[model samples]
Target chain A: MEGALMATEERSAKSDHADSSTGMLELRDIVKRFEKPGQGEILVLDEVDLDVEAGAFVSLLGPSGCGKTTLMNVISGLIEPDRGTMRRGGRDVSPDDLSLGYIFQEPRLLNWKTVRGNIEFALEARDVPEGEWDGRIDRYLDMVNLGDEHDNYPTRLSGGMKQRVSIARALAIEPEIMLMDEPFSSLDEITARDLREELLDIWKREEKTIVFVTHDINEAVFLSDYIYMMNTDGEMFARREVDIDRPRQYDDPDIAKREAELYREFHEHVVD
Target chain B: MDRLTRYLYTVASIIALLALWYVGGVTLPEVIPGLPETYAALVVVLTTPGPYGNMFYFHVWKTIEMLFASLFVSMIAGTVLGVALGRNETLESTLATWIYAWLAIPSLVIVFVSAIWIGFDASSGYFAIPLVITPFVGLNMWEGTRNLDTDLAEMAEFFGAGRIQTFKDVVVPQLAPFLFASFRSGLSIGWKITLLVEAFLLTRGVGFMFRRYFDQYDLPTMMSWLIIFVVFLIVVEYGVLAPLHERVMEWRPEAEGVRVTE
Candidate 1:
């Protein structure tokens, strides 16, 4: 435990020295269109723009049909923009230059593999050295509080537990940026709250850029450093930086105030 | 369900079969031999070497060899062909329908043509078995291939997975259940085609003994041979395929506990 704490301390010290003013990811004029079967083309992301600072947690807060997921897909380069320029460190670069870890609304695990094997699948895809695999799996699974359940299959896991495994799988790759698409929206309230705190704790220890997509106002207020509110027309019309302090609580007075302000802003613009 | 419940179901089926056999013996003695008489005939066939101057174990060994060899050959060929056809749209549209056309052509015609054209040998049975069973195996594989989850592929691609890793980890496991199902059914049909080829063309085999038995009107001996062979096949299918299905599909729900297989 002391050794792990020391390693984490060393990591945070190095990250603190690095640049934080510029966003790790910057998107401008990103537009994506999907063709309806019987009808014509419909714009899913209409010149959407976003910026995610290095070592900071950002939330894309929006209601349904607001293209929150489509924007996330554009940021991850899964869907090519009909017209846009995506840049890393304020310069355009190829996807090969950056590795991304994605957490879908569903766990999206390989049910045929054990929890350990699932993470190993990601590590192998990232081409982590074969010898370093065991330590990485142990650390990440332990971080997710799933060290003991590594041998279990996803089929036998509860919904919350499976989602935890997916989190571990993504973190195992140690990607440059973590992309989550409504990751906790499907879980029960208690599980979601618990995972939110766990995620915050991990974020504190290892400062990686995270772009979380959610429709829940409370979730956005609790987890993100900055919240970008998008409307149903796929336009990001508002942005806010939560002024509350860290180690936030479910019932913190400051959190409630931030949540109330966020809700008011969300209702004014995001609701259809 | 536990092991005992599964074992009991199998035992119950065997008892029902034995009861039916006893009734058939009493009602039609000349046609269906009694259990005791059949057992005695089986003992004779197993222990002795002389039946129309042919050794029983020799023929049994030959037929058993044919059964497995054909299945092994067909399984490899069919699975590879299925995966290929399933992944390629042009190949599927052009030749998938024609592949099943092999099934509609009777095994008898193929045997007669082979006899008239190439004459008789082990090669004839080997060719005939895979020809009869490949389409069934291939069809299941094609359907499984079509259902390959592209969402999972997108996830893998996002993770920077290479082509080989995607095929091994993602593609292969999804096709496993379909492959196992087709393999079992292939065994059932492939062995029959083996028998057809053996009886019509080959001279010194169990199929030849079957031909000789029919000629001499040896009902007890014929029934004994069939009963023993079928029992042998039942052991193989259950012992090998059932356990294999359990291992491959162990990640599935209720995989360990008893669920209704049928």
Candidate 2:
């Protein structure tokens, strides 16, 4: 438990020294609205204000249809909010300049590519130069502990392996900001539990800024440094800063109780 | 029954057909000649190597050459045009009416029209074959390219992939399985249409031989050459196209180790 806090502290200090510009991603007054020509306007998000600090793990928690996805998409530039200012590296940058890393709920792997081929594909697309490819591909696969299944195709992999490959592929590019949208929501419970631990370990190791979106309160409590809980009306109702030391066991009641309490707090906002 | 039993049933059916031919030759004595006559004629023509004997090989070879030439030309032209149409929505929608008009024209009509313009020569089938098959290949491949998984392309974009890299890594690989499937159907249709054109308009190939044999009422010789043509087509289907389809689509999970239509 103490070890994770120490690692986070060391990472913060190291980033403070390395270059303050590398880890900061900020969003300001983001609003996303949708409308049909014959129908009325639909406001998906309204004046959502949030700050993701350098190398901090944050989770956006809410019920279904609460616009956590819209917020993430706006940050990732998949959807353009009606009105907002997004800043990264202390300057207002477009989605292109933000260098966002995204992991969708499904693996979305190219069926034709082998596991290693899939990882190498991102490098090839980014033009990471042929010479550096061998090392970078191997290193990322090793991080996900998928080094052995590098030659297998996606069809041959289990659900868990496919998701791990996805994580490895996302991390390989070394993006300054990682955006995950309910990435583990579809997995078996046991696999999801294992992946959450693996994810935190990887997050600690990489020290990259992560903005994770999930509806699972326990998952948010267990994995996040700060929880930004949103109501169904697209408003950030509460921000819970969990000071629980990490590398804690999943079966611990203290963590479970906190997760339950957070869920109850968020549940009050849901109406009939 | 299993596949082996089904295969044996096909072979047994062929043997039964041959037996019926022999019996009908003896009993009816009025209809087509027996299997022995055609079989004997086949051996004679194969071994003699006369102008007539050698004509079969030449015509077969010429038909294959014309079929391949048209295939090569159409593949390159179709891929370029298909990609363009697929990527551009307005172009696809605008040209769709004309494309359908072209497709609706029959192969025989197209060859007859070409004969009027080109004056019934060896080159007639070559041009006619491409015209007949181009739209088919182009339309199928256009759909294939359009149906490509856009999510993978977005992944490519996230990795800073340029247009060419995204096409090569994401778009092209997905398109390959579809393209091969289209080609399997296209090539067979193209081969058949090329032979029909050769028979109807051209003067120097298997089609010509078939016409000559028909005029002479030499049923044995005509049937022998028809048998040879059928065998050649089977070889092309199994030996050429099936392998090509399997090789190109080897990456697809459903395509792996299992033959299409097996």
Candidate 3:
């Protein structure tokens, strides 16, 4: 298993050069701080650096309070880093220039809007051609297997279905990068597993860059081509290439072995 | 419970209350007028022409007009002001105290002030009712806007929604329940304030008629007017507002025997 991981890492390093030529998304020496009331300032992110190649599915895997979501926010232009530069396509990523789709831990759908309305809102916001709105919305909803629920309000839908709607809404925007912050973490095990498979299928079909943030090691292993493993201190301590093939199952022996090895790696950082 | 059972329970409660009122009227004739007398007075005023023509055609019409006008104006002004105050911290800090202060002052004070300024007329009722209702609506809306789910707004922003778009798509829909809440509460309070202003200052509407009947020692006429107005209020509340509220909030899942009070 170790040799397989090393071999995959070497292959990824070789491909990294080829992918970097396109300059998809780059984060260099990112730092963020927050004020803790009477405690003054606390550093949340410490000089983090990450580069995601175009159309790659990368996961930021760590425990709670590791600033994984914070990093996602910074990348999405929701929050400004205290220091460091974010570049896309070899240029500085301006808030206005970048097109991003974010899936929060919760579905965060507008309760008043039907699933179709939610997708329409995203389409209108992204300035998608008005003539194409219905087609795009129908396509994404069908992709997520929620084509029949377009007229149903979020409150009426089950949690898993609501999350699916969220996925459809995000995808309808046709974003350059999809930032997911533990979008499936709130679901039951079976639902989460099912959605994970659906998400991988979508990624394969759409070929969009995804920066998935999660604490679940198996999820990170199964979904990501490369996993940036961070410590509790909010630093990316290791990067591992998940050599497993596409459509990996949770119960697959190789995926489970990788998850166990990743857990060991995470625990070692905590001990250190 | 099913709709039929709910309606039955409501009707049963109303009948029981009317029975209690009838018993009280018989027990204390000086204080409470008998139902027969009140109903007879209602017939006379409603059918025959009075000093100001038919009481229902003129007085009740004027009062209803004032009630709706003030409600519309206050809803718009209060929602706009509340959204502003909720969004701006500086404005909230500067004006919140004043808003609460205005709310703390009784509607009677506004009625008196408006009467003195605008004179005893239909205009006085209009001015005073909105003054009394605006702060309540504004404060309720302020709370609603302040407690809006920011996560939804963030999602909107990430999808490339601008400020106005986000407010419309995200903020406004979330504020619908609160808007309805303020409207319901405002309607109830506005009617009382309009009547008070009319009784004390204005010489038109049902309130003025009530005052005139009371001054003339016409208990039957006054009790008749009270019954008619109360029934009207009940009808509007259940027929219009209750149905509207149910439709607006139908998307909410039924609570699991858990009561949430604000």
Using TM-score as the measure, the top candidate is: 3
Clashing pairs in 2: none
TM-score against native, each model: 0.87, 0.86, 0.91
- lDDT digits (tens) for residues B155-218 of candidate 3: 8877778989987878777898899989989988998888897788878888898899989998
lDDT at B38 for candidate 2?
Answer: 89
TM-score of chain A of each: 0.89, 0.88, 0.92
Q: Write the per-residue lDDT of candidate 3 for residues A116-229, one digit (tens) a residue.
A: 988898888888899998999889999989888877777777789889989998888888778899999999999898899899888988878899999999889999988887
Could you arrange the candidates by TM-score from highest to lowest?
3, 1, 2
Q: Each prediction's Cα RMSD?
A: 7.3, 5.9, 4.3
- List runs of model 3 lying over 4 Å from the truth: A1-22, B18-23, B50-53, B254-262
- Predicted model with the maximum lDDT: 3
Chain B TM, per prediction: 0.88, 0.84, 0.90
The better-scoring model by TM-score among 1 and 2 is 1
Q: DockQ: which candidate is best?
A: 3
lDDT of 1: 0.81
Model 2, span B1-262: residue lDDT tens = 6789999998999999889989987787657766888898788656756463575677778877888888887777777778788889999998888888988999989999888988778677878888888888888888887887777766666567788877777888877866776676667878788778877877766667677778887778777877887888888778987888777666666634532210
lDDT of each: 0.81, 0.78, 0.84
